[model samples]
Target: MAQKLQTGTSKTTRYAIWAILILTVLSTVALYASMFLSQDNNYKEAKVQQDNYKKYQEATEEYNKKADKQAKELSAKYYNSFKEFRKTPSAFKASDVKELEKKDLKVGDGEEITDKTTEFYAYYIGWKPDGSVFDGSFNKDELKLPLAVKKNNRGWGVIDGWSEGIQGMKVGGVRELTIPADKAYGSNGSPNQQDSAKSIAPDTPLKFIIMLIPKFEEIPQPNYKDYGF
Candidate 1:
């Protein structure tokens, strides 16, 4: 069994919900793996990685808590800025996911988001052509879109397809990316795949609605300066 944190209506935020969703899938494996390691008295490097993971999550929760009020405000600002571009997330007919494609619904005047850019913040909704919303950051005020791919391995800001697709988006832009499975979860679905009322199967092409947000809290990534990975 996994450990549970004390959460109440008063303390809950969208960010917290995001954390729970992430931890639910990934942390379980880490927790159980750490338990097995202790019993076996195994390799110390795994222990180090385990400790790093715990510390990273703790630091993140702290940041998310502090950024709660600010994040909502940012979401609102982005909403207003992109309201015209916003649309309900919907999917398309079966298409090859191997071919990466992108089209802009709304364009922004801000700086381009590139692999060299360190900070990334965005709001997104992901669904299939059938109109099933698999995952999204905001319940309202977002758009017709695709992935908010981050520049590099930097904590995998988005999927491989997203990484390439979201390259030139301005801070205020909205884009729709159609990703083939190869750039997404591929044949092996993600271990941390969001739990939805609808199932996301392996090898399924995905349609995503993404809005590159400015002024939201900075996404957490390891300091490359300190730890070169």
Candidate 2:
């Protein structure tokens, strides 16, 4: 009877091992099936995102090309009109410029700038008393697009001399402004992006040749979602 019990125990252990191995095989098969079924959806999502990004890139490129062309054409037209006044003054003294001075180069017959709150577009060249050009709206030989001067509490979002000097000036006009140090950059001076070597000095009087022009065609901002940005 003891011999028979030992044989039965061995058979039961073998059956248990077989059951574990079958369960493991089924689990592995189920895992692989699940992965296989979801692969199509994952691939579709990746393709959709890729297509949207491509569309965004194309649209942005087209928009930039058109805007650049329009700006260059506008710059070329007005640059020819204002190019003659791009000359340094013969004699200039910072101390002599105690008050804001204005010398009209070409007076315009267009709309008159009545108040400090008037918004306009302008092309300008600013220099020091020593005739060093610190900044301007020019790109080497060509003029860049006119910068939009928005209205502020002071005047056209500019310094005291510019606000006072440009008042009563009409569109399509060009004027030369000689600003005193107090009305210009004042004591702290200003930075020069064009010539990083020559920054505006403290108590430095400045001069500017300004040309006012009419507003250009507005370019709407591209939607970020449309560009996938």
Candidate 3:
């Protein structure tokens, strides 16, 4: 074992192997880091989309509730009279407007009305078959509405049904009148949409609660020009 130069691995070979190992480790680390970042980004995007979908569902629910409420209010017109209607009549039906039907809810002690009185100092609520109010005179002080028939053989101020229906009613008496379309605006229906979202349809039946007995007076003359009478 004299001094023999032991040359194990050369420096170049050792350096090359070390470099390859270092490069492989760096590449593996880079790949794992990139995969983690990508997964994180995907998770964040999915969460945001889910939140957006949840918000949309909530908004749609709210809108549906609001719409249901509005629809209920709109349809409430059919039964509103149950609050104070003393004698709710039977379900009304559409019939030919050739006759008038009258029923007394309460008879008064006052004298019966006369045809000489062209107008009556009374108050009334004109309700439709569905219990929706189409018109009313009770809002004003003792309303002086013209009678269906005048003193002379004059034209009817109101509908013919009302004229015939009020025949035997006395002052302070309440009467319910069922009027036909012919006695009202006729088959053409009223052009004035004065009720709740319902224009009086043609051939529609009408009901009325009329009360008599007040100071006799006259309303101001209506301008035909203004009302297109």
Candidate 4:
């Protein structure tokens, strides 16, 4: 009877040991599963962020390209119109010699001017050959823009006709400048001037009646004079 009781106690001890081992294995498997799931979530989030960033960069590039293209087109159109206006003869004739007479204006011949750069202040009425005024900036209250001729970098500022016609005037002089269509707006009129109906066509001839106000300061002669004999 003593031996049988001893054998039963041994069997109970072995069963308890097996239960403890199984519980430890299950706990380890659960911990590993949770860690793997967390890592996967983090990887997916990082991929999404990278994709969004790429799309934003592409959109910015496209916007800049479109803006640059529009600016180039506007500049080209403006220059082309100017070229066409230069070719018309009607742009050269004075519209009002009588008005010029009332002001006691004396226009100097193209030859008497010595300074390469001519400066003047003048009121102007610009019109198409058809007697349509497209742009006129003549007003006593308005500030006149100084125009210079033959200056190395300055001559390019004025329109082609103003540069060519203004050379004859002296300081405190006034005259009407009639620019031919080829030298004026040509087929494309002033881009800023809106028609009364808001439907003016491009490349229309431009005309102007300019008065010479004062001669611009002459460009300084280089010191090459000191080197001369």
Per-residue error for 129 in candidate 1, Å, reads 3.2
Worst 10 residues of 1 by lDDT: 142-151
Q: Candidates ranked by lDDT, best first?
A: 2, 1, 3, 4
- lDDT at residue 89 of model 3 (Cα atoms): 38
Per-structure clash totals for the candidates: 9, 0, 1, 24
Clashing pairs in model 2, backbone N/Cα/C closer than 3 A: none
The runs of at least 3 residues in candidate 2 whose Cα sits more than 4 Å from the true structure, single-residue gaps closed, are: 1-64, 89-91, 153-155, 192-194, 221-229
Clashing pairs in 1: 91-128, 91-129, 92-129, 97-180, 145-208, 145-209, 146-208, 146-209, 146-210
**Candidate 4, lDDT over the whole model:** 0.48
Which wins on TM-score, candidate 1 or candidate 4? 1
Local accuracy of candidate 1 as per-residue lDDT tens digits, 152-198: 45555668777787889898788988888778878876544355545
TM-score per prediction, in order, is: 0.57, 0.66, 0.48, 0.36
Tens digits of lDDT, candidate 3, 1-229: 7898858898999999999999999999999999999999999988877776666666667766765454344325322322244345345556433467888888877878666555554456776766667676432222323222344567446777777787778876788888877786678877574544346777777888777644433333324333222
Q: How many residue pairs clash in model 4?
A: 24
Predicted structure 1, TM vs. truth: 0.57
Lowest lDDT 10-residue stretch of candidate 3: 139-148
Q: Per-residue lDDT for 143 in model 3?
A: 31
